[model samples]
Structures are given as C-alpha cells and as structure tokens.
Target: MTDLECRLLVIGGGPGGYVCASRAARMGVDTILVEAGRLGGTCLNIGCIPSKALIHVAALFDTARRQAAGGMQGISVAEPVLDFAAAQEDCAEKVATLRAGVGGLMERSGVKVVQGHAWFRDGKSVEVESETGTLLVRAENVVIATGARPVELPGLPFGGKVLDSAGALALTELPERLAVVGAGYIGLELGTAFARLGSAVTIIEAAARILPQYDDSLTRPVRRRLGDFGIALELNSNVTDWQAREGRLTFQSDGAEQVLETDAVLVTVGRLPNLDGLGVGELALRMTDGFIEIDEHCRTSMRGVYAIGDVTPGEMLAHRAMAQGEIVADIVAGHANGWDRTCVPAVCFTDPEIAVVGLLPGEPSEETVVSQFAFRANGRAVTLGDTEGFVRILARKRDHVILGIQAVGPGVSELVSGFALAIEAGLRVEDIAATIHAHPTLSEALLEAALMQASMANHG
Candidate 1:
C-alpha cells in the first residue's frame, strides 16, 4: 500500500467534490480528489447536461417538423426526419467536451485527480483503489461528496426492460412506444423529449397531476402542452407489475385496471444518497431521513469531516452542493464562509419551463399582496409563438417587499437569475417597479408584475 498525505481529500469528483478540491487547492491547501467515474459526475456526464442537450436537439427537430407542417406563420416545408444515432453522437461529444473541461479546471487549480474508488480507512483517512494498486490518503480534512443514485421501486428493479434516468438517456434505439412511470420533472422531461422524437409516450403519475410539487396553475399549461404533444398522462395511477415476456405493464388508473404495451419502462420516483460502498457506517456518521446529517457548515458529527451534495439532507441540487462545497473549503482555508441564503431557485425544463424562487405562489398571509402578469401580454412571448404561462409575484401589502417570484413559460428558465438576484438582495416590489425595463421583452413581464403589485402600473 502506498501512503500519501494532503491538506484536503475530497471523495467523489462530482460538482461538490471537484469544486471543494479546486477551491482548497487554490487556497494553498494540498488537495486530492478521487472518483471512480468521469470527473464531471452525474450532472455533467449523464443526468443534467446530456439530457438537456438531447432536449434542445428534440426542440430543434420539433420546430423543423412543425414548420414543415405549416404550424408556424409563413413557414412550410417537408417533414424533417430525426437522426437518432446522430443525435446520440452529438450528445456524447458534448458530454466528453465538458468532462475534459472539468479535468482541465482541476489541473489548472493544482488539485490532483485520482481515478479510483474512495472509501474511509478511518475518520480522517481514505483508501483509494485503482487499477494500479491501493492508495492510502491521509488528510487534515476529508470531505464526502459522493452524491446520490436512482431509487428503485419494489418488484420493478432497474434492469432488462426497466430503466432509470441514466439508462433512459443512454438509449441508442428509440422505443416505438415508451411508458414513463412518474410525472415529476425527470419523468416529464425525458418522457417529453422521447415523445417529441416520434415515440408514442405515456406517463403514469401516482398524484392527480403532473408536477404535484408545483401548484395547479403552474402545471396546467404544461399539462395542456403534453396533450398537444400527443403524450398520454395517467393520473392517480400505479404500475402493479410488468410482464417482461410480452412487454406489457399491468397498471391501475382511475379505479380501473389496464394493460399498456411498450418497449421500455422508465421509473424515476426519486434518488438515494450514495453511501453504500464508502464504509460510511463504520465512520459512525449520523444520518437523517436516509441522508447524511449535516450542519450549516456542511460539517458531519465528526470533527474535520464534511459532507455535501445529494448526500446531505436538503435541496439535492448541483448549485446547492457547489455553494456548500465552496463554503466548506473557505472555512477550512481559514476564511469566513457560512451557509447563508434567503432562498434558491428551481427550474423545470418541460415543454414550457417553470421557475420558482423564495415564497411559494399563493402562500398564505394576511399582509401579503399577490399579482401576476401574463406572457400573453408580452411582445417577446407573442413573437416567439409560445405564450402559455405567466409571472406572479408575492410581496408585502404595506411596504411591497418582494417575498416570492414564480413563472412558467418559454424562456422562463433564463429569467430565474433576475428573480434569484432580486430576492437575494432584498429588493422590494417598488424597487423593481421603479427600475426602467427594456420594452418588448419577457423581462418586462417581471417588471409589470412588480409594478402591478406596487400599484404603480395599470394592469388589465
């Protein structure tokens, strides 16, 4: 066994681990990051990046198809056929480029990247096993950012015809008909992407509606868009069993049992923290609700041990992990950094994107005033020909301090930054209303909503 020493050792080169290692190394701390897979982790390799790349390609192909069918004004042509293999190749190329970039970033930041599986030897020591040999890394601080994995449902484990998000994304051959079992963001996003590429898609949701986390108003337009896309949605549905021999699924919906034949079934209920092969149980780290218990500083119960990302109980988002990683690194580097944020924004890239920050829409309060501005009234949305949602703002009725911002429509994902900034900086509704917004833009809709809430603009 080869023994090594470092100031910091980050296990799992995911967004959190990589960021923390880079920051710590740049701060003059000798850092080493270990990972069994590619450097970019789930978000960059398979989960978010590749999926969005395919989604964007689907959108482009869909636009061409619709234009060929004369769905748009002053546009007509022949049907555009989808090149599935080519699309797959393109996504792979993009993912590889990004993976290399992540490696380059680590190299420039003076962080050593170890291509191996990492597990705990002790509280502050880690053992890395690669193809060459065993590496024992002892550090002043060890951070676990192993992230999470797909959660499997009983009786329908992932394999064969059943697939998780990663499996679904890597599918080279598009199914003639794909049955997606879940209506959350992952299900809808991938399911919709498949449907756009000419697959007969059916979504089965246990809840009454798709995106049950979001209110009805925010999801209604998405529901309609799904219908327009010819994708079937079975609400309050449950998949009882799968008949692999015949490729049929036995499910119950609306109090009736039915059978749906499909080439593949994608189950995306949720994800669980990646703690299994890391010998975390031996470390005696506390767990909460199936995740690692972490404090504001991402500190575990043990001193000098930090955990972040999906392994922690909180928003299992990349940005959240990244921020937490940065904070942990700063604090370890003798800099003042703590977890402090009013709210974080969430975006769903369905047919029409959804963005939410701060207070939830229609959150109950006697002194709160709520107002909305429809995208139908926005010139940019009209020009884009995809006006199906609105931006709503919640603020104090007395002082007009902005509390929450929610929007669903085309390009609303791009507007999340403005909402995030406004809420994070403690900007008021009046402050937004007083600011001059560029005319004929979707951003103006935000200004209009704020102005309407402040009673400064006459809204119809």
Candidate 2:
C-alpha cells in the first residue's frame, strides 16, 4: 500500500467532492479526491445531465410528431424518426465531455484525484483500493459526498426487464410499451419523455395523484399534458412483483390484482444514499436514520470528518450538493462558512416543466399571502401557444416580503434562478412589482403575479 498525506481528502468526486477538492486546492490546501467512478458522479454521469439531454431529444421528437400529425400554424412536415442509438450516443458524449472538464479542473487546481473505492481506516484516514495498488491516505479534514443510487422495488429487482434511471437512459432501442413504477420527478420526467418518443407509457404511482409531493395547482397542467399524450396513469397502485421470465408486471390496484405486460419497466421510486462501500458504520460517526447527521457547518460527529450531499440529510439536488461542497471547502480552509442557503430550488423537467423555490403552496403560515398569474393572460405564452399554466408568488402579508415562488409553464425551469434569488435576497412583492420586466417575455408573468399580489387586482 502506498502511504499519502494531504490537508483535505474528499471521497466520491460527485458535485460535492470535486467542488470541495478544487476549491480547497485553489486556496493552497493540499487536497486529494478519491472516486471509484467518473468525477461528475450521478448528476453529471447518469442523473441530471444525461436525463435532461434525453428529455430535450424527446421534446424535439414530440414536436416533429406533432407537426407531422397536423402541421402547426401552416408548417407541414413528414413524420420524424428517432434514431435511438444516436440519441444515446449524444447523451454519452455530453456526459464524457462534462466529466473530462471536471477532471481537468481538479487537475489544474492542483487537487490530486485517485481512481478507487475508499474505505474508512479511521476518523482521519481512509484506505483506497485502486487499479494500481492499495493506498493509505490520511488527511487533516475529510468530506464524503458519495451521493445516492436509484431505489429498486423489493419484488422487481433491477436486471433484465426492470431498469433504474441509469438503465432507462442506456436503452439501445425505444420500447414500444414502457411501465413506469413511480410518478415522482424522475419517473414522470423519463416516462413523459418516452411517451413523447412514441412509447405507450403507463405510469403506476403508489400515491393518489401524480407528483403527490407538489401542490395540485403546480401539477394540474402537467397532469393535463399527460392526458393529452394519452399516457396511462394507474394511481394508488403498487407493483407486487415482476415476472421477469414473462416480462410482465404483477401489480395491485383498486381491489383486485392486475398484470401489465411491457417492453420495459422503469422504476424511479426514490434514492438511497451510497453507503455500502464507505464503511461509515465502523467509524463511530453520528448517523440519523441511515444518513450521516451533520450540523450547519457540515461537520459530522467524528472529528475532521464531514459529510455532504446525498450522504447527508436534506434535499438531494446536485446544485445543493455543489453549494455545500464549496462551503465545506472554505470552512476547512480557515474561512467561516455554513449552510447559508435561502432556497434549494426543485425543478421537474416534465412537460412545460415545473420549478419551485421557498415556501410550498398552501403551507400553513398565517403571514403568507398567495397570488397567481395565469399564462393564458400573458401575451408571450399566448403567442408561443403554450398558455397552459401559471406563475404564483407567496409573500408575507405583514411585510410583503417574498416567501416563495412557484410556476408551471414553458421554460419555467429556466426562470428558476430569478425566483430563487428573489427569496434568497429577501426581496418584497413591491421589489418585483417595481422592476421593469421585458415585454412579451415569460418573466413578465412573475412581475404580473407580484403586482396582482400587492394590489389584489388583476394585472390586465
């Protein structure tokens, strides 16, 4: 085993690890990052980047199909064929490119990266098993950002017929019939994409409604889009087991049993933190439930060992992990830093897309006031022919301070930054209402929503 020492050691080069390593190295701290797979981790390699790429491809393909059905506004074209292999190749290329960029940044920043699985040797040290050999690494500070993996159904294990998000993304051919096991963001996003790609998609949700975690107002348009696509939704359903031999899903819905035969089954129930290989249980670290318990400073119970991202608690968003990574790096480098986040934005890349920040809709708060501006009334949405959803703002009735912003419409995901910034900066309804939003733009919806909230009148 080769013995090495560094000022900081980060495990799993996901958004959290790589960011921490790079930032610490730039601060002149001797940092070493150990990763078993690619540097960009789940979000870059398989989760966020690749999924969004596929969604974009599916969207274009759907547009072509729509145009072919009955040319939109006099534009006529033949039906488009999706070359599935080529699309997968494109996603792979993008993932590879982004991963290589992350690798280059870590190298140029002087953070040493080791390709291996790291197991804890102690609170201050970890032993890595690499292709070259074994490595014994010790550091003054360590951060674990191993991230999470897709949750597989108990009865329908992942293998030939059942697929997790990664498996779904790696399809060589688009399935004619796709059975999605959940209706959360991951499932809905992929299921909707495949449906657009010409697959007869069936979404089986254990909850009573699709996107049960989100409010009805935010999810109503999404549900309407699914219905428009003729996508089958079996709500209040549970997959009992999968007959892998027969390629059928045996599920229970209503009172009796049911069977759904499909070309492929995509499961996106949830994610469990990647903890099996880390040997965290032996390190005497404080854990909550299954995740490592960390404070505002991202400090674990074990001294010198910090846990961030999916390995810790809170929202498992890539950007959140990145923010925590940067904060942890600064904190370790003798700079004062903590998890000072105002909003961790949640975006669902479903049809029309849904982006939310800050307080949830109908959240029990006496001081919060809610107002919405429908896209049907917005000129930009009407011109674009996407006037299906609306933009809503929740602010304090007492002070008019913006508490949360939620919207569902075309390109709302792109408008998430503006919403998050308003809340994070403690901007008021007057602040947004006073700003001059560009005419014939979707963001005008936000300004209008704010205006309507302040005056209690329509922005017509």
Per-residue lDDT tens digits for candidate 2, residues 1-460, read 7999998999989988899999999999999999999889999988899999999999888888888988976777898888999999998999999989998999799999999999998888899999999999999998999999888778878888789999999889999999999999999999999999889999999988888988887899999999988799998899887877787888889867999889899999999989997888668788877899999999998889899899888898999888989998998889999987888999999997999999986774666888899999988998998898999999888898888999999989999999999999999999898889998999999999999976753455
Against the correct fold, how does model 1 do in TM-score?
Answer: 0.98
Q: Which residue pairs in model 1 clash with each other?
A: none
Instruction: Give me the runs in candidate 1 sitting further than 4 Å from their true place.
Output: 362-366, 456-459
Output the worst ten-in-a-row residue range by lDDT, candidate 2.
Answer: 451-460
Off by over 4 Å in 2: 456-458
What TM-score does model 2 achieve against the real structure?
Answer: 0.98
- Measured against the true structure, the TM-scores of the candidates, in listed sequence, are 0.98, 0.98
Query: Distance (Å) between predicted and true CA of 263, model 2?
Result: 1.3
